[model samples]
Target: MSVGTTQTRQGLGSRLAALSRIVELGPGRVDPKLLTESGQLLLRAGDRLKLSADHTVVALAGGTGSGKSTLFNSISGLELSPTGVRRPTTARAHACVWGLDGAGPLLDWLQIQWRHRFARASALDKGESRLHGLILLDLPDHDSIRALTDTEADRLIQVADLVVWVLDPQKYADASTHRRYVTELAGHEAVTIFVLNQADRLSPEELAECVADLNDLLRREGVEDPVIVTTSATTGEGVDELKTVLADTVARRRAAVQRLEADLDRLTLRLAKAMPDSGAPVPLSSIDDARRIGLTDALCDAVGVPAVGEAMENVYGVRSVEWVGWPYSRWAAKLRPDPLNSLRLGDLRDEIKGLTGGSVSAQAAEVDTAVRALSDGLTVGMHEAWQNGIRDAARSRSAELPQLLSDELSEVAPRLDRVPGWWRLLLVWQYLLVLLFLAGVAWLGTALAYGVFGAGSLPAGLAVFGEAASLPWVGLMVLSVLGLGLLTAVASRNFVMLGAGNERDRLEREMRRRVGTVASAMVIEPVERELARYNEFYSALRGVRG
Candidate 1:
């Protein structure tokens, strides 16, 4: 073989390796039939390559009454394959081997029995040695009345190293033959040959026209640079030229590999046609911030995050009032319900521990909507099979979603119970103001009782001042004390509520962060994994085509 041809075969070997990778990665995302057929072809090609690179199995395939058997006998120089006036003479495949060495395994692989096998070369037949190592097969007629013959012909045609289509003048332009077999096998031009049998039946002028017309049809059908040989099987015209073609093909010992390369090309083309025409997908290793936020928000809706955050705020505000409100009126704050208790969030550790089969506060419809939205966005412009495969991947972890979300809620629960250290300080200060007010009230009441009843003089410490001045100063002191206490209470209310609002914001942030983790594990990671698989499959298919 030439260096260029050797390089081509090496390239084909790489392509076969790529095809094998594709089969490994293409279960759910590809048609099962395509995968099965591709896998079988690869196995068959590997087996053939390992058997005998020295022997080239060339199958002569044609429709009924195409003189295919006559050409086979003429080339073999023996009547191994029967010829008759019957409509379908070649009912079964017959193999003619030029050299018998190492041909047993190949014939066995081809499923040709011993009765149908013939050897053309021997010590006495030196002239036939030129075509040594050639295994010629006369396949059953493709258009025979029996379905078995058609199936057998197709089966042999696919596995043959080279296929020489026998076409006679009367049926050369048969539309069914061209459409069903000739055009469909367009990629195998390297391992294909055409024989115009019974060419002597037409005049020379007619023969030239027939050849030209056939060439034109082949070109229109996308068969490029095809090799055609003219021969009259009955008269033995051009039989030597056919032998020369066979000898040259067998000499190179590259037909088998070339045939496999063309097979890969055809299979990859089918894959390419079945795939979406969309451009290369944008690589996504992880979810972007926008998508992350969207997912988090959706999950929050599904799990009632807003309601929980509001409840935390209400609980904070209620507890703040009970701790720091006007001491005498703080009793009223205790009458209100604890929002956290109502939501079963007051003791989340116990709740989680007791959960045997408890679900999260997630809504089924909302979760479905969120997951569908995510899958749809990720799989835009993909093929339906691919889209379904990715969607299924995204939901692969769905059965664990309830438990995962429950864990998130449990994780964020302790944070809600946390109270600021400053709240205690404010509580102490409020009580101090109340104490001063009560002491002032008691002193004013004692002086007023003594002055109004005139039962006794003021206490000794107060004797230095006149009665009017003492009474007025004591009343003013009481009023001033009460005013200060009232002012303190009013001012502290805003600060307490502000603290409560901050706690609400913190709770919401923590919950969102936890929910984001669940979203990633439950949806984003699996979807990205499937997309990566698809990209790998696509790349491998491209390698196969190359």
Candidate 2:
């Protein structure tokens, strides 16, 4: 092969590779039937490329009584394909292979019977040298009585590198021929040729008119500048012209590649039509600020964020009372129920499972609605297949969501568990005040008992000036201690209430952050990745189209 030919082959190989990538990524985003057909074409093209680039397969197809077999023999210089006027003369396809050394695999790929295959290359025949490297197939008549023959003809026409439609004067304008083959194969003009066989039956002017009519018909069927050659098998008229066309096609060795390229072009266009109108990718923020906030709030509600924060506040209040409340009333704090344990928030995995699997929580339903809303927002104006694909991506990890959320909350739970050091110091201060109150009670009891059961005056040792003034002073000390203890308890209650409120706010913020992470992993990120895949598939499809 020349450098230009090698380069062309390389370019075709790259396009095929891109097409393969599209097929691999197209399962949910493209039509399944279209993808399946494209995949089959790729495999067929690969097998054809590997088998033979040196030889070209040209098939002659026509209706019954069109002299298709006679034209096949005239071009091959051998009576290889049988010719007869029987209703269904040729039952099977015949191959007159010029270079048969490496054509067995290709003919097998074409599904040609081995008995119908014949060799044309001979050193003694110089005239046959020009046709070397050509595999000429004489297909069964398409309008034959037997349906099987028509099927064989259609199959061979598709597999052949180039097709020569042999049209006699009688069936040149056959409706079935035009509808079934010519119109359908319109885009294959690059690798197609038309031959008006049995031209000896028509006068020179009549033949010209027939050829012009056929050209007009083909052009109407979207075949531009149709190559129609007039020929006669008995007189060998215009046979050389058809031979020259075949020889040149064989020499270029590009018919097979070109045929495959045409197939790719047709398939890619079909696939492209199934794609979404917009090719731009959706970003992560496709879930806009309002949508993000909505999703987060829904997720928070589903995971019981408000419940958890409220529980944290209540727990803080109970714990504060245990540490800083008056020692006499500390037991009452333990009687109040622990808010965290009531909601099963401590066992987050179980809570997550309940939220996701059970239908009782209205908040879980809100979560579902929010997630679906996000998917719908991103998939607007997309093809049905693509919309379904992106929606699937958004929920791809839905089963793992419960566990993921559980993990996140578990991490934040530790932060809420930490106890502040200042609470212990306040507990010490309360104990000191209790001790002072106890001492005052003891001193007053002594003064009261001495004044009631013993002498009328107080004891000198306990007196302030060894006189009755000690009685008033002792009573004053008791009142001061009682007032101070009440004031400290009041201050501690106020401090605990303030701290609990602050802790509730902190817990809420942290829970929102964790819920957001789970939302992103479970819904947002997957949707974004799917959009990215769509863009890749679109770019690869363009490469295949070229």
Candidate 3:
């Protein structure tokens, strides 16, 4: 169900579920102190909700000498409660159980002694028999001399399923009673009753004035739709009316549910106001795009990808020198380090890697800065608080991020070992040309020795290079060797340059993919989880409101 809708026809099971959920939520997302002891109240109400209370436990509570006991006696039709001029009489609570046999458990729970409990079957009076399940209580005076008497009365008020506040005509508008109890119980007006107990003490006009004043006082105290009945314990003027109210309430047997429902409603109001509005549904951008550009750029800086790319270009140049340099100079080129190897990247034979060794850890600030850059775009439409929170959540795993990037980059970065097949073919052809050049040099030298000093004998059929002829044949062979070798070097340099550009593109794309993966894992998921929790909190609060 949506959070804004109220369930008017909510059943018992729904109430139980709602009440249980409030307790389950407890003080986690919200502060418990702001709850005004609601957690404790909810627990107590939940326990009460489980009981099968057939009787509507109504308490007659009032101040000193208000004739509350007299009213209780008139309702019970017996002198069960002590009444006198004695100030603040009655210590503990006295319960009157009507037409109920197993009220023992409930009375015990109310802390009323079995000795103070009395039962009336109501069969003696046919007209008043409808008050059968009424467990009317003559509570100790709330303004009692003994502090414990007032404490007992206050405790009983909370536990009683229904309450009838008895007051005298003179003290009906008492400030203490209005401020202390009545106002606090404004939420429970559904299960509350108010009575001017000593109504016969005043004339009709004065009594009417008192009732009107009491009603105004109650309204001021925030109690809406109050039921104010004028009662006379001695003259019995409004005693029957009060009895009828109890009879109507007891017949319905809904006072307990109403009381608990009011408790839940009151508590929910106190807790729900602290939450921020969810507002309209705005589209939230995914973290992927931000990560691809922002995080990847940071990683490129920290991982030295540009430096690596430059070294790769230089390594191709180094290979060129080795391929085309004079024989002695070619050996000297082999002695120098391949510029790519100077990067200190750990063995990347298996995976296409971006960062290796401690390269990522060296410039860790880049990774940290990525959060700010990425979050600037990711949380564009979010509130300031939420944007900061999301940014914090995304950067929360910055400590482990470098190592994670290193591992993931290894899988995505272009492999350095990938040499184009054409480059290898060119290298083989160069080696064979060098061999041909040496063979040509040997053939020319042998002919020169035979023609000049006869240092050795030469077979007359052998020709230098291909077929020895006039027309600078020997010079042509010499030129062929040197010129073709230089051309080969030029071709090799162009081929590697093209390969380097392709490699750079592949590496950049791979780095971006890995960066997005890491950012989602470390950043986006946590914030989204918090969002999910907020929604649940909102749902539970709504469930409780219902």
Candidate 4:
């Protein structure tokens, strides 16, 4: 990963951490896969750079015959490789260490062990004496027969703290080199340098004109005031100045650290863009919530709790008794039962579940469908939003990304909305109702027998009826009827509670799934898309810079 990419990753990682914290407090947890993808990408980018506190490795990059090796030799005062007129030379990379006591640590970090060392000549060379930390690399020809050499060059550039791109007057405007490397390194302009090598080959006036043209091209590629150095290995012209620049870069150890930090900063900005705005967290418009609430409401309407209450009153109205102490007058008092006690709300759960289709699996399926529909709607809305932004951005030169995002998002909408299976609340309610009905019947029978039989006339062996008869039979019958009604009401309330509870749980699951879909579409997927775009843009940018 290059510094720009590394920076982008760090930014994304921070935002993901923030999102993870938010999810912890949310009603549902985010999917592990989503979290893992976000974390792993950033980690991988960070790992590639071998970032540390102490050192920075700068790479020298250029096309064939760009005089990169000659420049490298001049900078470190070491003839590490042969530099001559050849179509393709420097088949391998050469590293030169200046003034550094040990090459082991720096080379080890750069994954390069075969390097040449140059010691300072004198104290008068003090301006260049501290070249110990400077590691000058002579990379293979980028436009050569060996494709792997080019790949290696790219890899080295990504790992290097700073890059010095060499270019000669003749091929300065070469399309392949500029399009492939210069434009792509836009964000790292501070850590990048473009050297107009072989300046000695041209007259002073010609050199000045070439340099001017090159600077203008760089500016167009998004590099503002790029450091343009003139150098000639053949004449030793500007060689000392280049050395001074390298020495200065070494003295400021912060350059490498700053380069890495800048990478992190840029990555952070990209990741921030990927994340949803923090103001008002978007509530999930999931199908599960919609389905659960919709289906529950529909089932309730179907079951008719009020109608059940009315029916119970009509059927059991004759069971109530009044004036418990006036036992003899009980027969004359017309008995009436409070219908509320017989209304079994518990029975409604099973009925509702059956009517809606039973089991959690079925309910889950239904919820999935509802969720899919909601997702589809959301995708359409997002597509419109993306398209609108793209058009607006295109019209305003202020927009950074093209309308490609809108088209890409629109293409992914269908996949995101794919729905999956249903689960039901009626089964639980039915079971509760059955239990309540049985208990009611038993209580009714006991009340009747004790009221008619008299406690004293009961057989001596059957003491169970003693308490049953001792209490005013009529009053007890009235109380028994009331108790049965209460039992039914309680059962009804329990049915509603259990059903609602199940629905809430399903809603939570659906909400999580919905969030995962959205996150994947908006963040992970977009990151991948942007990565490709960045590569293309960077390649073009580098070309122009060269």
Tell me how many clashing residue pairs each candidate has.
Answer: 0, 0, 0, 49
TM-scores of the candidates in the order shown = 0.85, 0.81, 0.77, 0.51
Tell me which of candidates 2 and 3 scores higher on lDDT. 2
**Residue-wise lDDT of candidate 2 within 427-515, one digit each (tens)?**
78878877877876776666566654454554566553333345677678767766776677778878877877887688679878878
| Ranking according to lDDT, highest score first | 1, 2, 3, 4
- Name the runs in model 4 displaced over 4 angstroms: 1-52, 99-102, 115-127, 148-150, 265-280, 283-546
Give the per-residue lDDT of model 1 (tens digit) for 1-546: 568667877787788888898899988778899999889988987898779877999999998888999899888878888899987888789999988999999999999979999888752365487788999999998888873534888889989999999999999889878988999889899999999989889999999999998999898898998889999999999889988998999988889988998888888889999884476354646656787788789989888777666655655555566666677667654565542343355555343323312224676668777888888887788888878988898778776785678677766654444557877887788778778777767666665666555657865886533243466777687677667766766677778777667866887788888888888888888888887887778778778878
lDDT string for model 3 (1-546, tens) is: 222212322454465466456555444445557443665676666666555457678999898878899888888888888878777667777888887665777777788887888886643454257887788899888976785534888888888889899888778888888888898889788899999887778888998888888888888888988999998899898998988888999987778777777766776677666554456343343434545566666766776556555544544444445444344456665676653453344554111233222122225687777666765665565445555665776677888887787666555543444455776676678778788887777767665666444565545565332333422665578679878887777766776677777766666666666666676788667756645544455566677666
Candidate with top TM-score is 1
Which candidate leads the pack in lDDT?
1
Q: How far out, in Å, is residue 90 in model 4? A: 0.9
Clashing pairs in 3: none
In candidate 2, where is summed lDDT lowest over 10 consecutive residues? Answer: 353-362
Better of 1 and 3 by TM-score: 1
lDDT, candidate 2, residue 353? 34
Candidate 4 on 125-165: residue-level lDDT in tens? 64355565666777777778784434767667766778899
True-vs-predicted CA distance for residue 13, candidate 2, Å: 1.2
Task: Write the number of the candidate with greater lDDT, choosing between 1 and 2.
Answer: 1
Query: Which of candidates 3 and 4 is the stronger one according to lDDT?
Result: 3
**Could you arrange the candidates by TM-score from highest to lowest?**
1, 2, 3, 4
